[model samples]
Target chain A: MDSRAQVSIEVALVAGIAILVAVSLVNINFERLNLARELGEGGEAKMVATLIATSINTVHANGAGFELTLSESKLNFTELTDVDQGTGIILPIIIDNTRRKVIVGRNMSRTGHKGQWNVSVSMVPNNVVRQDPTARYPEVTIRNNGTNVIVYADSSKVRVVP
Target chain B: MSSNRAQVSIEFIILVGALLVMVIAVFPYILKTNELNKALSAARDGATFGAGIRGVGYQSGSVEAPPGRIKIKSVILERLGRCGNLECYRFRIVIMMPSYYSSNSSYVNSIRSTIRNQALRFVYYAFNGEYPASSVIYRVNTNYYSFNATTDVEYY
Candidate 1:
């Protein structure tokens, strides 16, 4: 081949290889960035789930002896006495529950992710027709981001009511 | 005829030499870039694992140790406060991978260095919290292969 033709071929080959390498590097970088984002999202979800579980356990152990009512929208531990409502006792319980949800929400919002969690308490009456003395209400379905968590409070379990 | 043949051979040799040089110079950059990307991805993966472990620990009422794959060095949990009426915990997880940092190649080394410093900070910011704006000291060996990490947690 003529010198000019040989030179043209060489230049074309070099350009082709460079373009190929450049394209490959760009693709690799894009993939890595995506993986990083996914990892961040997964981590946030797990944290939220943990907080939800702890709160339910605390409320089950200490909430005042109140009739448990479960509805589609609310789980009520009602009839809390004046003492039970005081900051000395109830504030910690409230704090425990609220904080768990808040952390989950804040993290999810910041990370642009979403998760769902729920907790509930219900009473099992002592008597069906006011006859049995061995029965008591127990808390149920305290889930942290869908992790099945069960915490029960036996009025019998309370040795010295605080 | 003999002289003409010799001239063609010399010209071919020159063309080959130029091609080899171009490949040598550019191929390393491409390969180095690839290695750096791989390390960055690994660092990000480790960070994600750290975050997940922290969350699990807070929920389970026990510190969930980071998975073995993550090579965690430390975990910190902070009690932040209630979310509405529920308790919350903030966790930090740190992991180390020696292979990522001790690379002799500049491309890999730069990426490894960047990831080592930024992984946790990225997680913290992603979680909507600010990281302390100070730089942490790191010691890297000649091969770019060792790492250390520290994580912090808060619960409310």
Candidate 2:
């Protein structure tokens, strides 16, 4: 082949490899950023779960008549930008009576990820946990009603008496 | 034609040299930043999980010590020991430091302090009760391999 042709082929091969590397790097960075975001969301979810679990345990431990109100001040559900409400229960917080644990999951539609980024913590209260069907967000009232810990979450418009 | 080819070769050599120099200069900074982020993330996760475990342990009043393990990136967290009383306890946080920071004392100290500060702050917020922030000690041991941080937590 001619010298000019040889040089042109060499440059094309090098440029092709460079493009491939650049594309790969971009992909890797994208994945890394997504993972970091997921990790962050998981951490936040854990924090919320911890707060809820601790409250349930504390209320149950303190005996009956002990009531704790977790307004936006305590349970910052805002931190969970895209939290899943779970199946059948329209509440983000789920009290698993069978497993004796509190599970907090994320809403997959907004997260754009398929990972199970839920946070679950074991609870001491074995009694049935009743959640207000109309419960929404920003506030949750947990009360030790002598037998079971009643948990209700709803907006300010709804009465939170437990 | 010969002279033109010689000039092209020299230009190629200079271009390659410049690219190498740029990579050499920027690679360390990127690595250092990555390490710092990892350390901070580890510290935060460590504190959060540590406090969560402690909270559960406090609730159950189990003297057997809560058995749990959390792995975050290059960090590992587990039960250290029982603090005699059920309310007081310790948990171990092991953070693996890359060899990059091992050679530089300042980097090691910076990473160590970063982990210590974040861990202490989160633990205090989540675990402290009547005890002051100062009372909760975040003991950090830095070797050439990893950062071993332990916190004496009290739930009141």
In candidate 2, which residue pairs get closer than 3 Å at backbone N, Cα or C atoms, i.e. clash? A83-A107, A84-A106, A84-A107
> Residue B94 error for model 2, in Å?
18
Query: A27-93, model 2: which lDDT tens digit per residue?
Result: 3344334334544555566566678788889989988998888876656555444343312111346
Docking level for model 1 = incorrect
Residue-by-residue lDDT tens digits, candidate 2, B53-75:
32222111112122132222333
Q: Which stretches of candidate 2 lie above 4 Å from their native place?
A: A1-21, A78-91, A107-117, A131-138, A154-162, B1-156
Model 1, residue A18: C-alpha shift (Å): 9.2
What DockQ, on C-alphas, does every prediction get?
A: 0.06, 0.02
Question: For each candidate, what TM-score against the reference?
Answer: 0.28, 0.41
lDDT of 1 at A52: 34
Q: What is the lDDT of residue B97 in candidate 1?
A: 40
Model 1, runs deviating above 4 Å: A1-23, A26-34, A61-162, B1-63, B66-156
lDDT for position A140 in model 2: 75
lDDT of 1 at B65: 26
Q: At residue B122, what lDDT does model 1 achieve?
A: 43
lDDT of each: 0.36, 0.48
The complex in candidate 2 yields a DockQ of 0.02
